[model samples]
Target: MVLKRVRANFKRFIKSNAKGQTTTEYILILFVVVMVALKFRGLMKEKITSQMDTLGTKIEQITNDSE
Candidate 1:
């Protein structure tokens, strides 16, 4: 009887703990995505700034030509 009770409790414990595996997987995926984003953020910002600067220069040239 004691062995049976222990086995039942072990089953319950296993069932209750099963969700942690999925939660851990999701957290790991989220962490990887955030790390990738952080790594590329500076490159993305630089590209955007360069594009804006080029656009500004073109706009200034067009305005000067018009004037």
Candidate 2:
């Protein structure tokens, strides 16, 4: 009887564990996405800055040519 009870408990434990595994997987995926975003943050900033600089240069040239 004790063995049967233990087996039943084990089955419940496994079912609960399966639910936890999916949440754990999602958390891991979120962590990886955050890490990747952090890793590329500098590159993204540089690209945006470079684009802004190019735009500023074009605007300055247009103003100078008008004058």
Candidate 3:
């Protein structure tokens, strides 16, 4: 029957090469993460720079006090 053949083919397709499909999914997720990072790259840079500046100021104050 036509319906039986279609069902059988669908099952076969679903069973075929599951490992490859899983890898593809992982790669897709990584791509999305990378894209998001790129989109926020400027914001991340500014925040990191601000934090570093604050850290440097604190370190300078500590050294001056010890001296």
Would you list the C-alpha lDDT of every candidate in the order shown? 0.90, 0.91, 0.91
Worst 10 residues of 1 by lDDT: 13-22
| lDDT per residue as tens, model 3, 1-67 | 9999998886676579797567768999999999999999999999999999999999999999999
lDDT of 3 at 19: 79
Every model's TM-score: 0.53, 0.54, 0.76
Candidate 1 residue 64 Cα shift, in angstroms, is 1.1
Instruction: Compose the digit string of candidate 1's lDDT tens values, residues 1-58.
Output: 9999998886777578878657767989999999999999999999999999999999
lDDT of 1 at 20: 61
Better of 1 and 2 by TM-score: 2
Among these predicted structures, which one has the highest TM-score? 3
**Candidate 1 ranges beyond 4 A from true positions:** 1-28
Q: Model 1 TM-score? A: 0.53
Tell how far residue 55 is off in model 1, in angstroms: 0.7
- Any runs in candidate 2 off by more than 4 Å, and if so which? 1-19
Backbone clashes, each candidate: 0, 0, 0
